[model samples]
Target: MKIDIVSVFPEYFDVLNLSLFGKAQAKGLVEVHAHNLRDWTHDVHHSVDDTPVGGGAGMVMKPEVWAECLDELLGLDSSTSESTTEVDDVSTDSTAAPVLIFPNPSAPLFTQRDATELSHADHLLFGCGRYEGYDARIPEYYRAQGVDVREYSIGDYVLNGGEVAVSVMLEAITRLLPGFMGNADSIVEESYTGANALLEHRQYTKPAQWRGISVPDVLLSGDHGKVDRFRRDEALARTNEIRPDLIERLDCASLDKADRKT
Candidate 1:
């Protein structure tokens, strides 16, 4: 996959060069290009933001800068630029890889499902904004242009800018890509992977006798079926204790009587 990140503070993404994202690039699974929005500026000031027009407390990113930078990155189909899209499979062709607008309190909330969907894209462009955020005209204009643009939020919180939010989103999505993690099995057993959207139950490792509490014998009985049942029960109990709403959302058809006991 190819990801283009447009941000004023391109230096902030240096962290990407040292972590799992860096490893993914090295292994040829993904490529990331971080562009400095100022490179597209026209004036001596090389400014990318300006005071709000109708009366606002902070600055808004310039629309012209976004247009120029994004055009240079994801240019028109007729452009002769070196940048081009190539998908290996028949299913991926002719799709406009989306540019995600980070979700915020004022917009729709982002979710794990969104991450999964973006992971399959051939290209993804993340636009980072500070101050009052990018001029509203930018996304509006993109929508008019028939671009695949949408907003998503991480949580019910305010982030300083979309740069770090892009990083957070990449980290969330990249780990799900095949081989990005050390143990693939770990993903299936993790919290929020299956019917359970709540945290997984507590796990006990050796020393089995730690702090005068014994690990459950069912875990050590060498019975795989028993272990699976024990784990499922623990998962159900933990969900009921902490997030009953998630349990209620789960399909009860799969639950045996033992699972509903709690």
Candidate 2:
């Protein structure tokens, strides 16, 4: 998969080169490109933001800068002097144009399901905004141009900018890509995954007898069926205690007789 991140602070993404994603990039399973948003500016100052038109307290990112950056990345412009700044490694799959995502606090909640869906995309473009945010008209205009524009909010709170949000989103999405993890089974058993969307069961490792605590006998017995049942019960209990909202949304048919009786 190819992901393009356009942000004024492109250096912030240097952390991406540290873990699972770094290995994925080394193997050519993922290609992540971070470009400086200010490179698209037209003036000497290379300013990308301005005072809000309605006299707001914070500045709003200019739409023109975003447009130029996006157009260059999409390979829609010709006869441009900023050839050196153009994105040359973009995918040309032609099945679909890259999905443009703007992280904000007002959009629909981003779920693991969204991450799974995006992991299949050929390319994704993230526009990171600073100050207040990108001009509202930018997304609208992009939508009018047949681009699949989505605004996603990671959580209920606000951040100083979208750079951190993009980082959060990239980690979630990239790890789900095929061959990204050593154990594929770990994906299906994780929290917010599978049909029930239950939280993961608590896990314990070595030193099972530590401090008067012991690993469950069912887990040590090597009885696969009983172990599965124990883990499911623990996951259900944890979900009920913490995020009961997820349990409420589960399908009635998915619950077993024991679950229903409980």
Clashes of 2: 0
Model 2 lDDT per residue over 169-237, tens place = 888888876688988853773446545698888898977699999998888888998888899899889
- Which pairs clash in model 2? none
Residue 235, candidate 2: C-alpha displacement in angstroms: 1.0
Q: Give the clashing residue pairs of candidate 1, or none.
A: 103-152, 103-153, 110-153
Q: What is the C-alpha RMSD of each candidate to the true structure, in Å?
A: 3.2, 3.7
State the local distance difference test value for candidate 2: 0.83
Model 1's TM-score against the true structure: 0.84
Tens-digit lDDT track of model 1 for 1-262: 7778888788988888887778888887777888899999989999999999999698889899888887777674346454454644333432455564543335676656667666667678888888788788887887888777877667777888887677888887778777777779536633464354655667888987988899999888999998988888888877788878777777667677877775
Compared with the true structure, the alpha-carbon lDDT of candidate 1 equals 0.75
